[model samples]
Target: MPLWSLWWAWMAGALLLAILEVVAPAQIFLGFAAGAAGTGLLLLFGLPGLAGSLPATILVFAVLSLIAWLITRRIAGVREGQVKLFNHDVNDN
Candidate 1:
């Protein structure tokens, strides 16, 4: 198959995996989907050669996922603290 077609396939597969991840609520496939999405983005940018691109994309996705997780954790922590303050009054009733 052609390179463009293969790229589209990868993107479609990534979208499907993301949807499945949502349905199953497992974080595993999300990484793979993120990697595929990164690859698709690279292809969209007209990056030459597929040899190094896939691995690079995977690495990028891994790093990004880590950062996102950390940020989410921080946000959740703050939200939890806020909830406690607001909920204390409700608990008295």
Candidate 2:
């Protein structure tokens, strides 16, 4: 394994998720992609502690994902009445 393989994995995951976001346009996968890419960047930049601990890296990814999700939601809120539409009975169609 390369010394920065883990980081590379994160970056690769980010790339895949980014592609997924493009294919789906759901505003979900992009957030995860951002988080993973951000984590990879942190690793690439030589952050301490995270480079040495798997658990720490996972935790960081989770935290970053959450933050990214919230930011994405804030910046691009659901379309008006989108939720109520989803809640409608499918059988009614």
Candidate 1, 1-93: lDDT as tens digits: 454335676688779979997898656667667666766676667666653555654565577556645554565435534653454665585
Clashes of each: 0, 0
Which regions of candidate 2 fall more than 4 Å away from where they truly are?
Answer: 1-5, 79-93
Clashes of 2: 0
Tens-place lDDT per residue, model 2, 1-93, is 444436888899999999999999988898899989999989988788888887888888888988998899988977666775366776896
Note the Cα lDDT for every prediction shown: 0.63, 0.85
lDDT (0-100) at residue 50 of candidate 2? 87
TM-score of each: 0.50, 0.77
Deviation of model 1 at 31, angstroms: 1.0
Candidate 2 residue pairs in backbone clash? none
Model 1 segments more than 4 A misplaced: 2-5, 51-93
